[model samples]
Target: MAMDRLFAPPAERWQAVSPRLCSLRRALLTFWLGLLGLGGAIVAGVVGMWWLGAVIIVVAAAVYAFGWWLIGRNWRSWGYAERGDDLLVTHGVLFRTLVVVPYGRMQFVDVTAGPAERKFGIAKVQLHTATPATDAEIPGLTPDEAESLRDRLAALGEARAAGL
Candidate 1:
């Protein structure tokens, strides 16, 4: 079978994550690169190795540019779809991941937003199941969207569990 056929696309279109997620990722990347540059500068000053510092700076710049491009693709790769009895979450740039979480199997759901995520007005929804390995998460949703999804998933999970 062809690789594309291994994971066929769902009937419904995927709901993409918020674009603000790219901004959040960019901010994080910039912060980390800034720290690396600072550390390199300190080391160079202490060791009197200005050339080493320049090399580090050049490498950091290259990484930052690559990361910036990758971040957008990564953001675009993330998507979720609410099906009849399950939720589908898909993401990844190189290694694709497709998670199918049945409502009945959901033990609990959580909505979380870190300081940086909140700064970008986005949150993540995590679904826990009987086993940790099958758990699925969808990130980069607006606060309101995350709350509604959490509530809806909770209700569906309860209804399905009651049937079993």
Candidate 2:
């Protein structure tokens, strides 16, 4: 099957959903904040007659740029998909990780919307499992979508628990 056609809606039972990631405004903010801090340190060091000011500024700028690049790359690679019996989360650029949470193992689901998420009309769905240490999460979902998913997951867990 063709790649585009593979992702065509309806025919594909599972679809990947990801947050919008960093907006242009957010990226600009990150860059400017980084630059500002670097500039401030440079000025302070120069005033203090520190010999390593130039090197520090250069290193800081490089680190900041690298961090921004990583964020953007990871953002593009991060997404979640809900299949028949499990929720799949795929993330990371350098170290790819895929987490599968089976419905039967789900303990509870939480649908939460923070200020930033509300501004973007997005919500986060956290799926708690019997696992003692880890909680599965699907961030950047629409409010209605998240609620619907939560309900469906809850019902599935309940049905599975009842041996349905």
Candidate of highest lDDT: 1
Model 1 gets an lDDT of 0.91
Prediction 2 TM-score vs. true = 0.69
Candidate 1 clash pair list: none
Report every candidate's CA lDDT. 0.91, 0.70
How displaced is residue 124 in candidate 1, in Å?
Answer: 0.7
Candidate 1, residue 41: lDDT? 75
Model number with the top TM-score? 1
Please give the RMSD of candidate 1 to the true structure.
Answer: 1.6
Candidate 1 regions with alpha-carbon error over 4 angstroms: none
